[model samples]
Target: MADEYRPEFIRRKFTITESLDEVLKQMADRYYQGNVSLCLRASIESYREILEGEGYMATRRIERQLENLVDEQRTLLMEITSVRSGLQESHRESADGQQLTEPSMTNEMVRIIELLKTTGDGLEFGDLVEQLDLGMHKVQPALGRLVDRGVVTRTGEDGERFTLAGFSQHYLRSGP
Candidate 1:
C-alpha cells in the first residue's frame, strides 16, 4: 500500500536531428514550463492511442485520416462563419444612409480594380493588358464577367474602356 502512489517509468532513447531537439525543447518550455519528461509522455500517448485499439499500420492510417477530416471540418466551419458575418455586414447601412454592399470578387478582378484605381477617369483595354501582363484571352473574359456583375463599366464609342464602378470599396477579398 505504501508503494501505490509511487510511479515507475520505462525509459527509451533515440537519436533525433538537432532541429527536432530544439523544437521539442521549445514546446516543453512553452506548454510544459520546461517539463520535458511530461511533454515526451504526452506526445507518446498519440502513438499509444492508435496502437491500443488495433496495432497495425492500416489502423494508424485510418486514425490519421479521421484526424485530418476533423481538421477539415473545423476549417469549413470557420469559412461558413466568415461568410455569414460578411452577409450581415453587406446588409448594413453607411452614415450617409446609403446601403453598403460586399461584392464577391476573384483575384483577377481584384487586380483589375486595383489597376483601375491608378488611373484618373478609367483604363482603356490596352492599358489593362500592359499593366496586368495577361493575354487578351484571360483579360477579355474577366472584363466580361465584371461587366455582367455590374461591378465594372464599359463606356466608349466601341466599348474599349473598362472602369471599376458601383462598388463603394476595393475590399480585395476572395475565398472558397
Candidate 2:
C-alpha cells in the first residue's frame, strides 16, 4: 500500500521586523503552544479570505480600509464622549456602594475599551495609535489606567498586545 493522502506545505523564508518576529514567537507560545507553523498558518488563512475574496480588488481594499478607519474613529469618539459624561455624574453617586468604590471610565479608557470591543482578536500599542487617532502621549496613561484597574490586559515582550479583561489569555500577533 502507498501512502496517498498527505498535505504538502509551502516553505519560504520571510523577513519580518524584529518586533514582529518577537510577537509571532509570543503568539505561538501562548495561543498555539509553541507551534509556530500552526500559528503562522492560522494567521495567513484568516487574512487570506479578505485579500483573496471574490469581487475584491486592491483599490477596493484600500478604500475599505480607509472607510473602516473613519467609521471606527467616529463611533469611538461618539461613544467615549457619551459614556464619559454619562458616567462622570453617576459613578460616585450610585445608589449602591459598589460602583462608588470603582473609578469611572474616562474618555480615554472608554475609547480604548470600545475599540477593543470591535477588534477580531487584540491590538498592540502601535495598532491603538493608528486606529484611535490618539498619540502615544494620550494612549499611554489611559492604557495604564485600564490595565491597572484590571479592565484590560497587556502581554508580550513589551506589552505588545491589549485585549479586554476576560480575553487576557487570547493572542494573535496583533498587527498587520
Candidate 3:
C-alpha cells in the first residue's frame, strides 16, 4: 500500500546517436550542473528568450499603427471645426437677410431693427455706435437708410433719440 501511494514522476525516452549523446553530455557538464534535467531547463529558457524578442517587435509595430490612427483623428477634428465656423458665419448673414421685408436690406439695417425693438425709448447716436460695434461713419448711413424706409423714427428737438417705427401709439401712451 505504501509503495502504491508513492508520488509518481513522468519518465521520458529519447533516441540519439552515440556522438550526439557525447555532445549533449559535454554541454550538460559545462552549463547545467552535469544534470540532464538542468540541460532541458536551459534549452527551454533559451527558447523563451527568442520568442520574447520577436514579440517585442510585434508590439512596436502595433504601437506605430495606434499613433497613426490618433493623428488621423486629430486632423478630422480640426477640419470639422473649420467647416463649422464658416457655416455659422454664412448662417448669420442669411438669417439677418430673412428679417428684412426687402432683399436689398443691408446687414446694418438688420442690426438697427434688432436694436431698436429692444429699447423702450430708442437709442442715441452714441448708444447705436457702441452697441452696433460700428463707427459713426457706418452707423449714420444705416440710420439714414432706416429713416428713408420708414423703419425708424428720430425724436427730440435735437433728434438725439431714435426709436422703432410702427409702435407710436404704444410708445406715446407709455412716454417719459
Candidate 4:
C-alpha cells in the first residue's frame, strides 16, 4: 500500500521572481512521479544556499514563514482526522439496531449543537448526558434522531458516541 502511494519528487531550479505559490504548485504537480523525500532534500539544500547568499535577515524571515506553513498544515491534518473519525463512526452505525427517532431537536440537543459549533469539538456521551440532565436511554435515542437527520455524526468506534456533523453549520448559522 505504501509503495503504491509513493510520491515522486522532481528536482528543479527556481528563478528569482518565482512566487512560493508557483513553486508549491510545481512541486505538487511533480510529487506523484518518484521519491519525494530525495526531491525535498535537494530543494531544501538549494534553498539554503540561496538564503545564505541573500543574508541572515531574509533567511530568518523565510524560516518564520516555513514554520507558519507547517503549523497550518498540522492544524488542517488534525481537523481532517477528526472529520474522518466522525464519518467512520456514522458509517458503522448504519447497521446498528439503534436509530435516531426524535420528532424534533430537543432544547438539550440544540444546546449541545451550539456548544459543539462554538468549540469545534464534540462532547463525550457521558458528559453530554450529565450536562443535559438526561438518562442514557433518552439521550441515545435523541442522538440517533439527530444523526439520522444528518445534523449530528458519531465519532467513536462504538456507535454510542457522536459529534455534530458539518451539516450543523446550517443550524449554527440559521438557528433551530
Please give, for residues 69-170, the per-residue lDDT of candidate 3 as tens digits.
999999999999999997565434232223333457788878887887677778998999999999899899989988997778898689899986666435
Candidate 4 runs further than 4 Å off: 1-103, 157-160, 167-176
lDDT of each candidate versus the true structure = 0.72, 0.76, 0.76, 0.65
Give candidate 2 regions above 4 Å deviation: 1-103, 156-158, 167-176
Estimate, for each residue in 1-176, the C-alpha lDDT of model 1 and write its tens digit: 47677678988888989998898999999999999889888888867866676446767788999999999999999999999998678645444323323456566676776677555557888889889998877888877777786767876788788765653333322211
Error of 1 at 78 (Å): 22
- Number of the top-ranking candidate, with TM-score as the measure: 3
User: How much lDDT does candidate 2 score?
Assistant: 0.76
**What is the per-residue lDDT of model 2 for residues 112-154, given as tens digits with 9 covering 90 to 100?**
8778866756799889988999889999998998888776787
Find the 10 residues in a row with the least total lDDT in model 1.
167-176
Q: lDDT order of candidates, best first?
A: 3, 2, 1, 4
Better of 2 and 4 by lDDT: 2
The estimated TM-scores of all candidates read 0.37, 0.36, 0.39, 0.32
Provide the lDDT at 8 for model 2.
Answer: 94
| Full candidate order by TM-score, most accurate first | 3, 1, 2, 4
User: After superposing candidate 1, which stretches have Cα over 4 Å from the reference?
Assistant: 1-104, 167-176
- Tell me the spans in candidate 3 whose CA falls farther than 4 Å from its real position: 1-101, 168-176
Q: How far out, in Å, is residue 9 in model 2?
A: 99
